[model samples]
Target: MKRALLALTIVATLATPAYAVLPDEIMADPAKEARARDLSRELRCMVCQNQSIDDSEAPLARDLRLLVRERIAAGDTDAQVIDFLVARYGEFVLLKPRLNSHTWLLWFLTPLAFSVGGIALWRQARRRARTSTERDEALSNLTPDEEARINQLIATEPVSEK
Candidate 1:
């Protein structure tokens, strides 16, 4: 019964629509079509919430795709089309926002953070190693008899089997 229930749950989950975009609406003009597809990849589908315009079936995505084709057909360059969209919809419409003064930190912070973290980790490891060496030196000062007693105590402990 449990196996049957799990199977049914999996089937139902797979039945749900992952995307609703239809292939028929894609343009056939080679250059313009490529630009349209590229623009679609850059633009976010607002209606679908989390999909790129190319992958979304939302009405807004269809409109945006058509807009891209229209602009490209009108002899607008890809950069111009992107600028127009950014001007009309703000930078939020772009999947990858441009790097500007405000975004400089965002662009560079990942590497900066990793470098800082690496330095901190190295310092901490060095400190630990130094402390461990000091501890070993102190232990070495103990007579050989003391080391033998400590090993014997450890060896006499009971072992637990899993």
Candidate 2:
């Protein structure tokens, strides 16, 4: 029925891969195709900005995918393909940036900030705990007469404002 067809369509859509690699773009040699696919995952799609070339449907992504395959076909090593892309597009072409003088700050900043925030939270919690225990200790140290006076004060009715 219509409901069964709809359920099947949903299942089929979910089963399909999100990648944009076309059958025509795939290399004939299995080894070269594997290499191309691996490299495609590392390269960024220039037009899509946030997506890897392998995952992007942009025209520029297709061109870059083809270029990677062409490089592999021409006997370029994986390192050579990466180097060529880096040289042509700068470090921004890579999905994960390389660690260098320019990127050292970017790599180290997140962990440093997380450590600082964690330490700050720990100190704050300790301070609150100490203050609360000090308050309880003060209450415990109160004389029986003082405690009676406090209870009396609480039990007394407030004076009416005229």
Best by lDDT: 2
TM-score of 2: 0.88
For residues 48-143, what per-residue lDDT tens digits would candidate 1 score against the true structure? 757888888778888888888888889999999999988988877888878998678888999999999999999999999999999999998988
Kindly give the stretch of ten consecutive residues in candidate 1 with the minimal lDDT sum: 17-26
Q: Count the backbone clashes (under 3 Å) in each candidate.
A: 0, 0
The local lDDT score (0 to 100) that residue 4 gets in candidate 1 is: 100
Over 1-162, each residue of candidate 2 has an lDDT whose tens digit, in order, gives: 999999999999999979899999999999889999999999999999999999999999999999999999999999999999999999999999999998998899999999999999999999999999999999999999999999999889698899
Top candidate, metric TM-score: 2
**Which stretches in model 1 have alpha-carbon errors above 4 Å?**
1-24, 143-162
Residue 16, candidate 1: Cα error in Å is 17
What TM-score, over all chains together, does every model reach?
A: 0.71, 0.88
- What TM-score does prediction 1 earn? 0.71
Candidate 1 displacement at residue 116 in angstroms:
2.2
Lowest lDDT sum, 10 consecutive residues, model 2, at: 151-160
